[model samples]
Target: MNKYLRRALAPLAAATLGLTLLGGTDAVARPIGWTAAWAASPQRPSEGFTANWAEQGFSRQTLRQVVRVTQAGEQARIRLSNAYGTSPLRITGATIARAGKGAAVEQGSVRHLTFDGRRSTVIPARGHTASDPAQLTVGAEESVTVTLYLAETTGPATFHAQGFTDSYRADGDHRADVSGRAFGEKTQSWYYLAGVDVTGGARSERPGQGGVALFGDSITDGFGSTSGADRRYPDALADRIDRPVVNAGIGGNLVLNDSAWYGERGTARFERDVLDQPGITTAVVLEGLNDIGFYEAQAAGYDRPTYFPAPRVSAAELIAGYRSLIAQAHERGVRVVGATLLPLGGSDHYGAHAARVSDEVNEWIRTSGEFDAVADFDRLLADPADPERIAARYDSGDALHPNDAGYARMAAEVARVL
Candidate 1:
């Protein structure tokens, strides 16, 4: 018996027995409901990674994107991340409006944030942060617009896409305004603005139910997705699914134990990111490439200075680790899905040596059949001519991350299975 399993089961079995003995059945059964999940995409828009550039005429200024709710009467929350920066970001103000366009050209008390009595907050670059709950009285299908203002930036920002669809031009170094008018009416924007918390409310709505978790790496985390596009696959998929889809992807996450890139391995964060989620029913895990690619990229007899080390686990080791993860999820009654990696043949993140590891890991993912369901993202988006390469059509020019269109393809593919 695996040590982790032994430990987990013993306590659970004991608790179950105790409950049975002590009339635990008297406890109310909490209905499982879904929450809105959103994540930035790994693809970059035509303006490049930075949405506010001097030449682009949109820099220094902050932008706003509003997500109006299509379904009303449910509670909602806002989540934010500066997941791709090398430094910290200081936000001057963040606001939620009644589905308005632009910054409102003003700030008001109506702004609901994930903070305690504060209009401004700071987010560490390369890390993620969630806002305090903002309660609102919404109708059956109303909308709420969220606007954010930042002081400084070190790297380009990435965001989930479904809520707001308009673009922006940075005003200067200190400001940017929402561009044009909302794509209102028939726009059918799919990304979320405020996440519906639906955990506690009148049983009348019967909102609580099983939720889907977008469990994976940066792709699920929205690493390369356009800043304002809200086109990341997870966001796209969330818009398509009627149930809640929470984004649990962390940038640079790996499947097997290796070095720490973003605090801990994805497996280590699994309990917190997936199981601990408020109400998650299904989990789609898209990981492993980082372990394979990073491992293969290491120097034959040298060490790199970065905190993250590469390709530590062999193909067999990763397979074993994956099986363990699947078993764990199944034990908890959560369905586990595996996503084959996109090609890395030309990514600056990959080298010839590293490429081999990616290939090996991908092959195992296809044949292992360990996952409850498989999301063959590699085949759907990878270049057909060069099986080991991301299709040019999908490549975001970085050769590793997908473009907006590519992410759409990914979202469509996964939606089909769901």
Candidate 2:
């Protein structure tokens, strides 16, 4: 066939092959408005609030983590991070499935994941990658299991401490294992797992199936909520909202400073953790409590491995961080909702100077009118009589963090504004 004949035959051949050629590339399982259903902010490896596997890393072991999605989807993918790794990270194998009780997975739901069409790929130092989309169906508020097998030693892994939910590990190649018996050792941290995104599903009422991100510190991380109950404010908000809601909170996180055990500061991480969430239309930021509190704790000589030297941040500086997050989100066309710092009078964080700073910052968040919306968590959770302390009923014995009831109240307030 010559030019004329071949040109004429191309249309016929393409029609018969059921293909709509786009620049001669295949269109199989292409992304359809990916929305982040779940996420975890990455942290440097360190001795933390709980036992973490980062230092020991993994060698010929299968690490399994469970996360709950707030968006229903037809297909899904997982994001793996080597954010703080000094050397290239090699992923030998990985899998995803519906989560079951205690390290177990729902049978017949397992799906092997690939990266750039390969079963294995190397993540460059201080880098990350998302697995190719897998044909897995997950429902809103449902849990999914992700298992990774490291055939070789991965030195000092990057991870998220204070996951609140348990993660399990087993020796050998159990990437596809659905049973809990094999995964006996357990930890309370998420290792090298940054986020889980979904696409190729029904678009929600919002364009591109947009999701909302709840970004904050320990309270948003569900530190005081019963372990594994999924009672974080974001979890509760997802129940009330019509669209997807993802938790981007890190326990002990500061708005103006980074921590070895917590995570990158809110301003430094807002774009990647909140705005970058696939189709995130809005973000509710409830940070800065740690910034104010940690300073006092450090000055008072309270020592903990998770506690770093708290920077002496002024109220204006804290407000600057909030302004930065708002501006960045606005640039992305994502709405920003400001939240007041919760009361701290009864906690170790409360000092006269810290109290004055908190009051000033909270007032700005309430009155600045710079944010698209505001959630006055301080006024809402404050004791009516004292006004400086969290109400006894809502306090989780820590006096700083809220209990499950308090989290529910917070969700209601956020929903009312959002």
Candidate 3:
């Protein structure tokens, strides 16, 4: 037997025995329901891979990260990604368990994760793989720690930078460790792992059994929120709604172009990040800030040439992009909730021209009648004294993203609309 399977048998046997003793037969139940409990948008490897990734290419290491599940389930599985890798990625072993404090896992709660009943699997370049379902029961609003052992030499790793939570790493294989002692280093980013799905019925079949995907930029990615606290607007919204709220926001993401540090453009990634999410019946779009800000900087005579080639866009062009997303979502029977662009007048990039453009876009988002519904984010964050600028209490000092209090307001606004 593989090393991973051998190490995992003890915990798996223990869990099974405990379940049997407790009269828990849900693991063997038929017609399993699968819903997304948590999700993160994957982006291409950063240019500063050597500094950011920490581990060297061809070296062996284990990565462990904790994520909060918005919906509970009887069984669970994880998705590993190599979406932007230049070479095949090999996973020697993987495991998931209930999180205990920092990097530790609750004793006896660990489960061995596999792919097609195999302990090890190789994912091809630009591909993603899902683990075979494991009998790991997770509850709503609970934290789960996932550990993966990368045993082969891989190219620049695909990762999400602004996780707003701490992830741990250690040398050699520690995928089955129940304690955080082996984890000697810490980072605030998620690598390889993408989505976590738990088996369950639809919302109509079972209460609190659906999902909402937040398609957005840095604001939605929890850029300024407290790390590891799950204070993002979507996180707050998840607490209010009956469905799981998945964060698909990539920091610095753009709608019209792929000029940001993260993955593909918003329009290009909607299918994989939103449409493909399990049990996602609704998607809230809070993008276009990056797209608008980039050009705004150029228009204000900021001479940073090599940053990004500014694309001249009109309010009409942005509306067309929103329309395409709406059409795609409608085709899949998914409701698209359009969010009005927030105030940006106080930021360095904002000028009279950019303000005019923002006004135009927000105007259409409120009155276009193109989206199934609208979340008036602009009205929620804008200062009444100076309608073009963010309220002083809501600004996160950058004049762009919102503070935690601001995120709470945004979440409350979404809840009202839902």
Candidate 4:
């Protein structure tokens, strides 16, 4: 066993063997409390900007990305993923430190991250690796910069396309650099890195202190929200709640079927994205918008036969999907909190039939009692004059996603239930 795992599992081993030191003093091991401090859902490289990343794989370069963590801790670990890679990924070195002004690390705060005591390791295709715990103190709402040096060519890297936060890239290896001088290029997506876990410390001792995971589509993904500011509804909700909040949303994602541009369907990824997250006691599901919107486009005869397939879905089918998600969460002892789909009346794909279906599904969410609780995002963001449309002030001009103000209101609504 790796040294870190052995250390982590020592308590379990001693308990299983019923052994104690010669003095008969019971050796009580300190429980290692892990909490999901930050996370970004991984997605396959698709067309447009993301495809460019797939083509230009990293070689002899350093990639430094900043992630804002919700839970504070005295020690932390980093998770790197090659979930969709076509070849092995080798990391020559890596460092984690408190983020400074821009693309820079705070002086005297940089710490080396190791894997089972090794400074470097190879991640096989479709696999992931987590670093050994590093002694780096961080406070809640602090941004941490993780720098990685790729010694080999990484082909078709698995990445989260819409990080909405700037990441820096520079030629040659600079994983140990403490300043931003080496970085020359900026990108707005997170590559390879998947999650940041922190030792729970005192927070773990509190009753019902487990984190909340927000699972949804673009709205939850912070599409219309301001970039680099973390203004998503989940972010706002996290600011209000004491427990950690992890955003598992993907832009253009669907609940039942996978789209080319979006990542996997919500049903397919629920276990890995939500159920597998450490310390997640509650899952707030807000999906089905794209599914309904696509079906509406097909009904309106706006779907291109070659590009877009004709979508057929009903309110019953959507409710069944929700029920499946709720049952899965319940099986894992995670409270399921359903969120009603927001209004999209002014969207280009909105149709009268789609509006009716949305109403039917929302009514089921509100009255079905299948979920432990419900967040009425639809009611909160809908226009008072026309219940079908979103309020003018809240709409992001796309009608599909919400503006920062709208997201704040959505967060306020979710806060009441959390």
Ten-residue stretch with the least lDDT total in model 1: 11-20
- TM-score of each candidate structure, all chains considered together: 0.61, 0.91, 0.89, 0.91
> Arrange candidates by lDDT, highest first: which order?
2, 4, 3, 1
Candidate 1 per-residue lDDT, tens place, 1-418, comes to 3232232212111211101112376765332232433322211111322222211211244455544332333344555544444457566666554554443333332444645457666666544444545555554233455555555443544333222244332333222223333222122122112243432333223433355677776677665678555566676776676655666665556776634333356666576456544445577878777776655555543354432445456667777767777877787777777777788886655666556656776677778777877788888887778877888878778777887788888877777766
CA lDDT of every candidate: 0.53, 0.83, 0.79, 0.82
* Number of the top-ranking candidate, with lDDT as the measure: 2
Instruction: Indicate whether candidate 2 or candidate 3 has the larger lDDT.
Output: 2
lDDT of 3 by residue, 1-418 (tens): 2223222211111111111122366445334445678998888776542235723433588889999998887778887778878788998999999999899999999998988779899988888877877888788889999999887767678888778888998899998898899998887888888888776423425543356889998899998888789999899898887777899998878888875365688888887888777667788999887777888787777775523787877778888889889988887778889999999987865876677878999899999798888999899999999988899999988888898899999998888876
Stretches of candidate 1 off by over 4 Å are: 1-73, 77-99, 105-196, 199-209, 258-261, 300-307, 351-353
Q: lDDT score of model 3?
A: 0.79
- Predictions ranked by TM-score, top down? 2, 4, 3, 1
For candidate 4, lDDT tens digit of each residue in 1-418? 2333233322111211111123346755344567778888888766555424644779989999999998888888887878788788998999999999888999999999988789999988777778878889998888999999997888777888888888999999898888899998888888888888787455645756588899988889899889999998888888888888889998878898876677888988887777666678889999998888877777677744321573677899888888889988887778989999999998865887788889999999999899999999899989999988899999988888999999999888888897
As for candidate 3, its clashing pairs are 33-199, 33-200, 34-200
Superposed by TM-score, candidate 3 places the C-alpha of residue 33 at a distance from the truth, in angstroms, of 2.6
What's the CA error at residue 102 for candidate 1, in Å? 4.3
Cα deviation at 290, candidate 4, in Å, is 0.5
After best superposition, candidate 2 residue 267: deviation in angstroms? 1.3
Where is the poorest 10-residue window by lDDT in model 4? 11-20
Regions more than 4 Å wrong, model 4: 1-30, 50-52, 298-307
